[model samples]
Target: MEGLVDINRLASGEAGRALLERVFQDDSERFLRRLRDRVDRVGIDLPAIEVRYQGLSVQVDAFVGSRALPTLWNSATNFLQFD
Candidate 1:
């Protein structure tokens, strides 16, 4: 599945819930509670974010748009170029 990832920033449970609600189309409050329960039961660090359905993991990445992509204008520039 195609997913968008914003640059890292501090997050709170409320924000996490909102994000999940918008992206996953599920009940964020319930999902958050369940996630917390699972983590407490297993005693491990819960993931900051994850997007998957069934068995397939969604691939997400952050990228600047065409203005940031390499073009004829930057073709001569080295090192900083992005394909």
Candidate 2:
């Protein structure tokens, strides 16, 4: 399924976000490999795959409710367990 799954298309609702999270959690190595190969094939010497992977990981984490920050100041302090 080369080039079949567009990650952008999966950034919609909860289910799509969940699917993206699972994809990264399951086989992130393969995903990065394919991403690098595709980018290299296009003759683009952009950022390292590891760097891109880190950014993607952060994005996925936010979508999956892991890296989200509280909106209110009090809530932020409570969320972080600060005294």
Candidate 3:
């Protein structure tokens, strides 16, 4: 819970799984709030903002999706190596 949490280790336990979920939820909310503030400060119209938000969301989804496969592969390989 302090520094450098290993996702594979965290996923292995109930408490760690809950903590990971909470962390991700909090991070996502924080990111949206910051994005909203930035758009407001820039005086973007609602329609334009929505477009930008959609673009940002797609990028984030793609980025996270891209990394997930590699992370899972590495985790499995690591577990196999250790086991």
Whole-model Cα lDDT of every candidate shown, in order? 0.63, 0.69, 0.76
Best by lDDT: 3
Candidate 2: Cα lDDT at 29: 85
Comparing candidate 1 with candidate 2, which one achieves the higher lDDT? 2
* Deviation in Å, model 3, residue 29 alpha carbon: 0.2
**How does model 3 fare in lDDT?**
0.76
Give every collision pair in model 3: none
How should the candidates be ordered by TM-score, best one leading?
Answer: 3, 2, 1
Instruction: After the best TM-score superposition of candidate 2, give how far the Cα of residue 49 lies from its true spot, in angstroms.
Output: 24
| Weakest 10 consecutive residues of candidate 1 by summed lDDT | 4-13
Distance (Å) between predicted and true CA of 10, model 1? 34
TM-score of each: 0.24, 0.28, 0.50
Candidate 1 on 1-83: residue-level lDDT in tens?
45855424423467875775576655666799898899899999755887768877778544466544777654455335533
Indicate the TM-score of model 2.
0.28
Stretches of candidate 1 exceeding 4 Å from the true structure? 1-26, 46-83
Give the best candidate by TM-score: 3
How would you encode candidate 3's per-residue C-alpha lDDT over 38-83 as one tens digit per residue?
A: 9999988776333334435333223345444668776686567659
Q: What are the root-mean-square deviations of the candidates from the true structure over C-alphas? A: 17.8, 15.8, 17.7
lDDT of 2: 0.69
- Comparing 2 with 3 on lDDT, the higher-scoring candidate is 3
